[model samples]
Target: MSVVSPRQIAANLAELWSPRVIADVDDSYVKVARVEGTFGWHSHEHEDEMFLVLQGRLRIDMDSGAVELGEGELYVVPKGVRHNPSAAGECLVMLIERKSTLHTGDQVTDKTRSIADQLRPL
Candidate 1:
């Protein structure tokens, strides 16, 4: 096994909203992404998603309200909860999600990256 740095991995990203798998744990994949602007509103029907802010800040807009997260903060969007994520500036985030999780959930957008794309070597 080898140690991976989220910050370093995020820095290597050349595209926004593209997530790269860094490791696998049990039935989940550990991913890191660099994002700016806003992602589409969507929800995972059968899987919960965990987002950890490694740099900058993230805002998760839900039907109820919005939850803001800063560096080193984390939030879990439960299954079936429609939510959109936005960042005022470049943000680095780590995600822990089921191996079958889709980047854009049920909504396929131009920003959606296929599982094959995400599985590319970092």
Candidate 2:
């Protein structure tokens, strides 16, 4: 085992909305991503997605309401609940989800990323 730095990893990301798998635990994958603007509305049919803010701010919008997260904060989007994520500026986030989880859940959009793409080494 080795130490991993989320901050350093996030700083090296060259693209937005692209997630890189950093590690795997049990049946889950640990990921880091850089994001800006807004992501398409979507939901995981069989998985709960955990989003932890490493930097900047994140706004998760659901039909019922919205939740804002800042650095060091986290929120878990329950399975089957439609949600959209947005950021006023650049944001770095860490994600934890099942290994089979899809980036865009049941909704496929221009920003959709396959597990193969997300598996790229950091």
Candidate 3:
């Protein structure tokens, strides 16, 4: 397989919050997205979500606490924990989740993206 760059995928992102699948690792798909503002509060009831910052910063606010991540940092939101991810400015992030994981989880928002959309040509 050819090398895939998360940064390159992030750089080419055309829409905020719209993750594009960059690669597949077994049952998980690696994705990249550009983000800013608030992504709304949501939770994955059965799937843990992993977020890795590629550029800028990200803040994930959860009911228990909040975690701030700078570039190259990563955070995993356990399944069933409600959380909201926000950025004061533009940020690029890589996500690793099961193929069945849904964007926005228990809540559907304007920014919600579908698996078909994520799997499209990038």
Candidate 4:
């Protein structure tokens, strides 16, 4: 068991998009990621995906258009909704997804999804 600081974790991982699992309880995993570029278009069949921008800009592309998220902004993709996420520049973000949810719902392309694999020490 351990206690960690987000700021310290952020400073330690200042140059990568790798996510560190900060906590896990019940059916939820809390993680932090550094992001840039565009993520693949995908959807969760049974879970909602939450993205919280800790810094920089992030956007979610919907069929209708795009929703831009700034620092402190958050966006949640509803179940079974198709969308693509992008960031013009490097951004810090926190994600909350179901413990059993796949990073990509139905999309199976190589770049279709990202799972939080590395849990950095915080």
* C-alpha lDDT values of all predictions: 0.96, 0.93, 0.95, 0.75
Task: Compose the digit string of candidate 4's lDDT tens values, residues 1-122.
Answer: 67866434544665454566787868888877777888778788899989888888999997777789998899898888888988888888888888877755777765433553544354
Which should have the higher TM-score, number 3 or number 4?
3
lDDT of 4: 0.75
Please give the lDDT score at residue 25 for candidate 3: 96
Candidate 1 local lDDT, residue 20: 95
As for lDDT, the candidate ahead, 2 or 4, is 2
Q: What's the alpha carbon RMSD for model 2?
A: 0.8
- Tens digits of per-residue lDDT, candidate 3, 1-122, equal 89988987897798999999999999999999999999999999999999999999999999999999999999999999999999999999999999999999999889989999999998
| Candidate 2 stretches greater than 4 Å from native | none
Q: What alpha-carbon RMSD in Å does predicted model 3 have with respect to the real structure?
A: 0.6
Task: Pick out the ten consecutive residues of candidate 1 with the lowest summed lDDT.
Answer: 3-12
Candidate 2 C-alpha lDDT tens digits along 1-122: 78999867986899899889999999999999999999989999899999999999999999999999999999999999999999999999999999999999888888888999998766
Specify the poorest-scoring 10-residue window by lDDT in model 4.
Answer: 111-120
| Residue 75, candidate 2: alpha-carbon lDDT | 99
Q: Of models 1 and 2, which has the larger lDDT?
A: 1
> 44-86, model 1: which lDDT tens digit per residue?
9999999999999999999999999999999999999999999
